[model samples]
Target: MTDNSAERRREKQPRTGAEQPWEPEDLVISEGKDPTPERLEEARRRLADEGPSAIERSAP
Candidate 1:
């Protein structure tokens, strides 16, 4: 029989960014801390317009 435990060791671990993926703060469009109201509005506007196109857009 094959040694399956070796394969278990090679399993990929899930990424854990500081914030959970669904948090509102995670979607900030501002450069850094203390985002202005305009920046927040712009971020929200872009999200409303873009939808799924904004998510995980990078190619394989």
Candidate 2:
């Protein structure tokens, strides 16, 4: 190997799909609700503003 830091940096770059995929349980289901785009937006908004606990509270 050459004594070049730039070449080492390029070699250590992440591959595709290096992270774990979510399971079915990763999806939070609410009663009488479908997993639609609107719901997804709302969840995202809640999560962004107030985080996971607020999302759980506001979801159902």
Candidate 3:
């Protein structure tokens, strides 16, 4: 059997808060597609209004 305690610890660790403010790049509109200016602006607004949770809500 393999010792997997370290991996488990990493997985169980709470996520750290954002070190920097959200940027347009942080908004992933799609996997491979690039975001348009309008989408980026929308994301920016959402980030301002909703905080980090906007990222998850923006993408599919």
Candidate 4:
């Protein structure tokens, strides 16, 4: 390429060339409970505060 620094920067990006068609309706997660907006918000908060271990805390 014209500039080595520009090529390096492009390589460090998080997104890849191939990706799925992103859609909000496709996200349907349930922890054995009804998919309510409040429950989803609580789960998000728990995950952010507790990290990956939060998933295990949910009852099957």
Report the C-alpha lDDT of model 2 over 1-60, residue by residue, as the tens digit.
568898889779764321333222222343245667776666566555655455345333
**lDDT per residue as tens, model 3, 1-60:** 999999999899765434346687567443234787877787678788888666555455
Which portions of model 1 show Cα errors greater than 4 Å?
1-24, 29-33, 55-60
Model 3: lowest-lDDT 10 consecutive positions: 24-33
The deviation in Å at residue 6 for candidate 1 is: 26
lDDT (0 to 1) per candidate: 0.46, 0.49, 0.66, 0.50
Model 1 error, position 28 (Å): 1.8
Residue-wise C-alpha lDDT for candidate 1, range 1-60, written one tens digit per residue: 889886787565543332233222334532344556765676566556665343333111
> If the candidates were sorted by their TM-score against the true structure, best first, what order would they fall in?
3, 4, 2, 1
Candidate 2: count of backbone clashes, pairs at least 3 residues apart or interchain: 0
Kindly report which residue pairs in candidate 1 clash with one another: none
True-vs-predicted CA distance for residue 48, candidate 1, Å: 0.2
Residues 10-60 of candidate 4 have per-residue lDDT tens digits of: 788755311333121122242556657876677666665765445544423
Note the residue pairs that clash in candidate 3. Answer: none
TM-score of every candidate: 0.38, 0.39, 0.50, 0.44
Task: Please report the TM-score between candidate 3 and the true structure.
Answer: 0.50
Find the 10 residues in a row with the least total lDDT in model 1: 16-25
State which candidate has the highest lDDT.
Answer: 3
Deviation in Å, model 3, residue 57 alpha carbon = 4.3
Candidate 4 displacement at residue 35 in angstroms: 1.2
Cα RMSD (angstroms) for every candidate in the order listed? 6.7, 9.3, 6.5, 7.9
